[model samples]
Target: MNSKKLALIQTAMKLFYRKGIHAVGINEVLKVSGIAKKTLYHHFSSKDDLILACLHYREQLFIDWFKQQLDAVPAGKAAILAIFDALDSWFNNRSPAMGEFNGCFFINASAEYGREDSLIYAACQQHKSHVRAIIKPHVDAFEADENKSNQLTDSLCLLKEGAITTAKVQAKLSAARDIKPLAASLINHPLRQANI
Candidate 1:
């Protein structure tokens, strides 16, 4: 992409995240981006097109950040649980200048675009699926049996989603960390009782 286009998208993303999609208009994006109407139109055919681009960009940004955090830990329970640690850091304003945990950009977009079939909503779902995909590997490695692995992966995903939503709603920065014990219980608990 051209520098101008990238700049526009980046600026629009910041405004959309800070202000909101519906709240921030194209005029604001243009003003903040400092790009001419022709240039903005040249890059994106419409505001909806730009919104989709922002969602795609956010998906990549979040997943890449998640991968880095997950990879920092060695594979196992530590790697599996690192997802929440990452979220905790996000919620705690670890990067005050960046992210600052605005309750999942994709989640915010999902609310803005309520139609299930809408591109915006689909992008949000795709972002979540990527997160689940990342967790699946750790789960498979932890659980030797394929069936057990699938079940554990689903549970972990639920825990992660729950933590995210709860943290946002309750304004609890440690919500992710707080859920660690429960997760540990699930992981430490063997799938079956031995000789029971």
Candidate 2:
């Protein structure tokens, strides 16, 4: 991507994440990025196009960061639980790469673009699916039954979403840590029964 286009996307992303998609105007993006209006239009046909690009950029950055955090811990159940620890760090503003916590960007996008058929909404949904996909492998590693593994993955994803939302909405900075015990129980139920 050209430097101008990348700059526009990055600027728009921070603005959108910090504020809301509808709240930030193209003019603001241009001002923050120091890119010309004509250049933004040259790179993106419309503001919606730029919004989509920003969403894509945010997804890749977030996924890469999330994967790295998971990889730092042991895999399987331990890694799955570490997700909350990662989220705690993020919520506490410890992870500078993720920027300040303003709730999940995808969640914010979905709210602004509530229509399910809209491309922006779809992009948000895709980000969520990617999150679940990242958790699935860890769940699978610990749960042998396919059905059980799928359920476990769903539970973990739900917990993650809850943590993000609570941290943002309720201003509960320890939301992630607060929810960790529930996740630990969910992930270790079988092992506990077996005394493992």
Candidate 3:
């Protein structure tokens, strides 16, 4: 996209993440981005449109960063366990691209847009599904059975979501680390030994 549009989305994302989407108005995004109202209108038809774009942008940023983190480690169980280490970095504000930890952006968005059929809610769900997909391959490597792998993937996603939520709500920076052993146990369960 053009520099102007990218600026609008990034600025809006930062603001929307720091504050709620409804709490940050279009004017603030315009002012922070140093772009004109007409320009924002040219890129996005409405605030909701911009919000959607921001969500997509955030998802891409997160997915890319998360993949990089996973790639740095060996695949299979190591890569799976690296997820929490990555979350720990994120919770500690080590991810510059993601900004400070205020909680999962998708979770916050889902809370705001609670209606199941809404595009915003759908976007949030899509983000979650994408995250689960990313973790599936690693789970598959360690769990041969299709059903077991699917269940393991879902369980890992739950642990991830719980870490994010706990880190945000309880202000426990070690939430990811704290939950890592449980995840390790789940990965190393007796039923999964056949694949390993």
Candidate 4:
């Protein structure tokens, strides 16, 4: 995609994610994206196609950002903590248009589409798998034993799911605060201090 088309996707994604995919129409997307209808249609066969493209673009950006954050953390305990650090960065950002930014784009878009057959869904699945892979090592480092590692990894996933839901409902990070203590006690203390 050219810079202009990529810009349209980026702009449309922010609008779609903020408002909703169903609520935001093609004209609004064109208005916000500052792109001509002819150009937009030339790039995307339909609104659905544009939505899929936006999702793919967003997914790539998210994966790149995640990898960068993961690489910055120290292995083992520090890496585990970096998960929360990344969440904090995501939640703490303040914008005039989108305030707290609590909603998960994948979850929201999936809910709006009401089905799982689009490129967007595929991108979301890939993101989830990538996140699981990132968390696996942290789980292993925290527990040492394979069974224990798997158990903790599952537990951490629960925490993540809860955090996302809670943020969505409450529109703030109170639930994330709740998860922190449990995560600290469950995954941090013993694991980081092990081998004593």
Cα lDDT tens digits for candidate 3, 5-113: 9999999999999999999999999889999999999999999899999999999999999999999999999999999999999999998876899999999999999
What are the per-residue Cα lDDT tens digits for candidate 4 across 1-196?
Answer: 5988898898888888888888899999889878899999889999889888877776777667766766797776676666666665666663233234647777787777755676767766666777778788866764777866776776766777678777787766656666777777767555542332
Cα error, residue 80 of model 2, in Å, equals: 0.6
Candidate 3: stretches off by over 4 Å = 190-196
What TM-score, over all chains together, does every model reach?
Answer: 0.92, 0.95, 0.96, 0.83
**How many collisions between residues are there in candidate 3?**
0
Q: What ordering of candidates by TM-score runs from best to worst?
A: 3, 2, 1, 4
- Model 4: lowest-lDDT 10 consecutive positions: 93-102
Candidate closer to the true structure by lDDT (higher is better), 1 or 3: 3
Once superposed on the true structure, which residue ranges of model 4 sit more than 4 Å away at CA? 94-100, 142-144, 188-196
TM-score of 1: 0.92
Clashing pairs in 3: none
The residue-by-residue lDDT of candidate 1 on 32-60, one tens digit each, is 88899999999899998999999888777
Residue 77 miss distance in model 1 (angstroms) = 1.2
Number of colliding residue pairs in each model: 0, 0, 0, 0
Q: Model 2 segments beyond 4 Å from truth?
A: 190-196
